[model samples]
Target chain A: MLVSYQTLRARPADAQRQAIRLGEYQSHTAGLGKGCLQANVVITPAAYALDFMRFCQRNPKPCPLIGVSDTGNPDMFTLGADIDIRTDIPAYNIYRYGELADTVPDIRAIWNDDLVAFALGCSFTFEHALLEAGIDVWHISNNSTVPMYRTSIFTVPAGPFRGGSVVSMRMIPSERVDEAVAISSRFPLAHGSPVHIGDPAAIDIADLSRPDWGDPVPMPVTHTPVFWACGVTPQAIIRNAKLPICITHKPGTMLLTEVPDDADVPLFQKS
Target chain B: MLVSYQTLRARPADAQRQAIRLGEYQSHTAGLGKGCLQANVVITPAAYALDFMRFCQRNPKPCPLIGVSDTGNPDMFTLGADIDIRTDIPAYNIYRYGELADTVPDIRAIWNDDLVAFALGCSFTFEHALLEAGIDVWHISNNSTVPMYRTSIFTVPAGPFRGGSVVSMRMIPSERVDEAVAISSRFPLAHGSPVHIGDPAAIDIADLSRPDWGDPVPMPVTHTPVFWACGVTPQAIIRNAKLPICITHKPGTMLLTEVPDDADVPLFQKS
Candidate 1:
């Protein structure tokens, strides 16, 4: 299942996206399709789009922009052909005044000409790389959600957006730390490498047992917690700003894109 | 000097910049200060800065932005401390209406509050990486400039910026092609790996002998021409746009910065 350059022509992205559009698929997009990227979605008014784009540019780790829609245009042709932003994802979280108003299956009813959609690189792209390299993801193996925590590191502010970073942690044996770094760093769009390794308190995280989001997995005494800048950081920023309206894809569910996982080629062939 | 993390604090960048600023050294910056990143400078009006930044973002392979200054600011603190964008570089090329106006030792006289500066990742950064990995750059060995050609590859346009990409070619022994690709691919900011390898016709580059810029190097019979996206790409775009005014570093006489050669770090060094 190695997504090599020669094999990228296959169009699983179209079929998978169709399934999502029809509301046939509504769970986590963890292993939905191979050879293509899955993106975190954000929709906001045109007025806030430019500032939000600048925010993603300044803090690339938290929000690596895969594609930005033209004003009032719902089609993100850069990410794929015939893709409609409003109905392409399995679920959408509509926020009003920065608070969650309702969770909907489709944003088509609420989509407006003044709204702009942004597709962000998600960790699922790099997680595929890790699995291919024989690195067992702890939470995935334990059948639980990946643990995420709020860190003391503040994001670079953009317009009204400002907040501390939220990071996702994976506990691994000390020896496999290098493998984790090697596999993950290749996908800079997918948050890149570990921001803090071993010491949770370095980022002001007091406990690994109490994650701010998702289920916590048990770690062996020999394992060390490695943190990566999470896509959730932007959500935190959006929440803090309390803008007029912001719509996003619910966690786990995502907007799949046509881009290959090896957007930037990784080091070494998996021979 | 490997420019390792431990040796980065010595601050040789300041001394090298001072020598350039004093007019003490004016030669091509092939291997000036070790461990620091060298940048291709572009200064334009604040009116065009946003579009130009978007242009760089759209065409990252050709114009990889290392640091973009705050609008109307003459300093680029991201690349270095105490960086005066107008006069720090050894030389500047003033362009008016897409034509060369004057080549000056410093641009302080023309510097204005409406000007914005951009420091782009140069091939010099990756050339250092190649040499460290035992890859011989033909032009450097022959004491000539690397051959550059205007390619048929169209860059993604932003606003008024639009042009074909300009690529620089390096002749390498055919056997070392894999090694060259492996090593250079680590520096995405430095144009990453070869855009076209072996066949120039593939990229619509007709002749390698007669380059549009720089001295042409003799190619060994066993060598292949490997082309990487050149930083001159933005210059071509600027020329095409024919803006009111624009300024850039004279080719080969780049602005050196405190950032590392491997500004985009490789994987697996963490413990």
Candidate 2:
């Protein structure tokens, strides 16, 4: 059954997750699960889990951890009820030796007792707030992935995980930048405020037309290009480390959580 | 040289840490490191580090991680400059099988490549904010250790780390409770807002006089007992887990970081 944005938006978070789990929906989760928190998923072996968690802790803006699964436990019980990390997301990206090995609908075939899953906050939550505040999120309206670039800003090293921050760019009208910043700042888990504004050269990005990841949208002279630390960062770092195996959610496909977008409390406490 | 509160307050955080490292200071860090962030330290072997990190992530209010040392590395580089986790703190409590085995001024003799150090946010930062807001911190005024209790609030389990939350009690006037909460909420790293406010029995505390740790303060009728999730929570949980070996800072003694109390950025980004 094909799930439309209208139909998915009307359903509760668990039902949305259920559809995704059952393989009824397998597409980008944008505009789906309205008002719910969506997370970037990263699964790794127990050996690398500590360092990955430490990397996230050291670099919170780009890697805000919302939930971490118990080692070898496929169920992310703290993230939401009946959340099986092995199968819930729309799609999975399997990386081996730091390269994209394959993309699959679910990870049940590759599931192992030593794997640990992490749920990181994504920009979808704060993007909803921006739109609600009457701020234009250019890429959303243009139907393109938010442009992302590798910046010169180096993330603090944790074990073998270390890399420059990957940032998502949004061009906001000059008059509304502050308002957008304030609204986005409220969702620190969602990459928070802009790390760089106006000048791409300041952060060592040479060109606005080309991005390291995602599609670039039209940049208007009346607007300022704002860059926020992107959740894709960890993936880049993980790839650099050349780990034996790692699994992550495909870009734009996120795990929709029962947690409200504005929840201040940790997800585990809520359950 | 005996470092008085007045003299220590005038010195920078690194200097204060140096004094502690040199054995010139060996008391509670309560009044020291004014305007800087203080942390509760916990060191465990690499085998237990992942679960401990998960436990802290699961129970953030009580275990707000300020810095995590690279596995087998004693220097908490992200937290501050020249932070030798081995000897920077005033005192250390070595626990064997979760039993307090010794109290030492430093852990240099036992430091090994397998140990992972974690610096968690302590109440001192928020306490300072509370005091700045003109709120009376009863324990500080009385020169007593803040009374802490094991509440019925069970922390979300992570591996072997699971126990009820241990909370520190502060008597705030009934009218000022809201103000105190608002002030402390600004410092999420410092245990944030009170977990429980008025009645103690609701959280399963039988008496006000008896505390599991720290000294009991005189309760006044004019003030209501406010409880904030305490960092001692991890210690309690660690003790319950009975790990083969663990090390923690003595109660009241804390690691002072170069990060300012008002800084919202992750500690790693600062240096």
Candidate 3:
């Protein structure tokens, strides 16, 4: 059941999702379904779902919610007519009492009636726009996970959710930083514009060589470091909440949705 | 304590809110706080707050949530430094079992620890933009309420909230419709872009002259009817849900926030 990258790239978003569901593709979903919107997934018990949703609503830059499933429903009809939350994502991170206990391909074994699934927009969508705009996305070009750092910029809290923002870094040529902002700002659901542009120290990042998450890519002298609010923010905040049990898509292996990456629909209207 | 329009317009947002709170002002909020953001208010008991939040999240066009009070805590600190939900809005429409039970200047008597306040973006923000762009908003020019209609467009429902979208009509010069869209699209927190353009019949509006709500203004031959999702939608759907009790700002009277109408922050980021 091995699918070639070329063949997978040629298929539609639903087909790519089907391949992931059937265990045929289980790696990062970077280049697959290029024009499709990919989502960061979070599943929580219905009891805490409201607070978690409020957190996302309060801090949209870090957590732009694209869809929320009906309580206890495994299907995310709003995201896609046929998305199965329990299996479509290539991987799932299971957290027990605010700590990562396991990483699994699927969560069907533990699916329950009290769970709610939330889909959040990912940076990949804007990264695609950046590439199309002729801006160099260093991480994608170098075949590495984008470097992520937890910043001193605290997210506005809601209920049990409280934490600093986690941001992804890209070294953009100083001249193109404005262009990058204009392009990325168009995709608010995808983390929007860079939260910080020049100095990492100002946002409390001690080192560019080492990222709190993902791989660090090289920075050039002519380039300026740009930081965007990362999708991993919700996961970090959820962990801080120390919920009894929570589930999220493994970082970088997101749920590929049918929505086009460039769709101009307002963030709230997307649902 | 009749405050003159000129005097109120010269004061800051907090001062104006204080005036409203003290029963010195009890009229529509248009033209007041010209640069500040105004919001449609909806208050529900804690039991229905989650479902109502989900409804707003699902139907963001009609309910772009700008600020959500922490459960039962009515000082909407995020929206304004001293906004007391019970008294800040000039008027309150109390709905009991889906019926309009009373129109009061304040709801302090019925306020309880179990109620949650939600502030949604109002169209006035964009109408301000429209006027700045030199596009004529007929109703504002005529000093009449914007016409509203219940269209065939069914909102994506959540929990007991199910209803067709309610839209506000603006007859724009056909040539300026695109300009209107571009200007308004920048404010997604406000309804953002028209849901329907041109023929009213296409969206199931039988006549532009007779609206479901608001006063209808005359449409010129050179103009085209454009409709944006109206904030009244949440009230309509909340009524349909027939919650034991609900409270909303009386039509056209909204809560003014300190955030500038033109603030480029993402909708979700505003909270």
Candidate 4:
């Protein structure tokens, strides 16, 4: 059932967290956080904030920065009225030396003043735009994660970060490709437009059936595989960098911010 | 006489010291720097580089970043094969603590490693795109600087930086506004699209006739003033920050880089 705009708007950031906080709704926030902007979270020591911020800036397609918390501060007011970085997210992925250490619902116990939390715009925000445009998102239809892949296209390197671009694949029907691109392009804060269309091999993906992460959806004969720069990229990259302590939202889990879906940032509305 | 491409190509960055480097040919480089991308330059201490870079990222349309040299490094290889930040720009404006100190042809003597240079994509790059689409940039026709203004839009604050957006205005026939927007949006690396289309006061400009900078051109009865985020924004922002040391190119002067005018950066080519 589709939620009414009034219903969605009535749910505050804290109210949306109630179900998750009480363990009644710890699942993915795909549809529950309706109309509010969701984000890919990354918390790292201030020593790495500069480089990581640069990395995000350099590769905005995969890491569209929406907000940055003050050093060691858990609040992300820029993203919302009172976003608590420590406990607002439904789940957190702890990484040590670029490897996943554990998955937890919150990081209150580990939160520190040296840590700066970055809220990067996520595709979930744009998926709403797509759905509104009456475009079918394969993963949404299948009730599964979007198939993602490691591509040969390397992102512009910054400091110790160097890796091939990672893309999330969506099978949009041929006629809808233009519409999909047009709508997604409006949300530059959320990856913004397809990186590759038609032949996947051109970008170095050997097989469409075998994605690097998440499940692959069968491509319909009428559909074309539209690839978008994925938010998962930074997790893969910072992991490879082997930072001593880094925290990110676990895949499928995200940090919901108070930024309205209609946030008037021109960059988000480009084209 | 126009310098032949063959002669300009063989000339090395180190050998090209002034406007005469292009074989005594100095005609505003409007079409002369073909293939060689030109950039707006801003130099500041490392302490301010991060904030300025953040400011640029936040205000991309007005200050789209192309490259940032490593702290104290004069040779920004990413922008050009051997371009020196200190002398590549044909002219420079030295500002000290929020005031213009001098307009100099070169700053080699004052160059230091503690200083960082930022290369921002210029509207000149996207003007090529607009021209290709058959849009007339009025200033180009009249051979005058594009009219600019300080608007009511305030940029997001970072550290000591805060100021209204500085926009360059263009008059386009009402019928061509869509084409102008579609063509320019392809060059997000430059100022992507018109920030405002119809009314001047919509963005806080009281009178279009009296522009804050550049010569104002009359809008034909059938034309509309299409405003675009201008590269002069960073210069205005850095000036407002009142940093002890800041360097920027003169209004018409810019740093020429090796990024081909036709360089296939996917972001600029999309759509």
The numbered model that scores best in DockQ is: 2
lDDT of 2 by residue, A85-158 (tens): 88899989999999999999899999999899999999988999888888888777765677888888879888
TM-score of decoy 3 = 0.94
Across B1-271, the per-residue lDDT of candidate 2 in tens digits comes to 6676556656887688888998777777886788778999999999999889989988888999889998888989988877899999888989999899999989899999999999999898888888878898877766567888989887888889998999999999889999998988878889888899999999999998999888888788989999999988877887889999999998888898888887776473443
What is each model's TM-score for chain A? 0.89, 0.93, 0.93, 0.89
DockQ, ranked from best to worst: 2, 3, 4, 1
Query: In model 4, what lDDT does residue A8 have?
Result: 40
Supply the DockQ value of model 4: 0.21
Q: What CAPRI grade goes to candidate 2?
A: high
Q: Which stretches of candidate 3 lie above 4 Å from their native place?
A: A1-7, A266-271, B1-12, B266-271
For every candidate in turn, the CA RMSD to the true structure comes to: 6.5, 1.8, 2.5, 5.5
Candidate 1 lDDT over residue span A1-271, tens digit each: 2232223223376666777787766555666567677888888887776567657766778787667776677987667767799898878888888888988878888898989788888887888888888877876565456788899876766567778888988887888899999888888878888788988898999988999877788888888888988877767778887878999988767788877778663111222
Q: Which pairs of residues collide in model 2?
A: none
Ten residues in sequence with the least summed lDDT for candidate 1 chain A:
A1-10
- The DockQ of each candidate is 0.14, 0.80, 0.48, 0.21
For model 3, the docking class works out as acceptable
Off by over 4 Å in 4: A1-24, A32-37, A70-73, A129-136, A171-187, A193-212, A215-226, A258-271, B1-38, B75-83, B129-135, B172-187, B196-212, B216-226, B257-271
lDDT of 4 at A229: 91
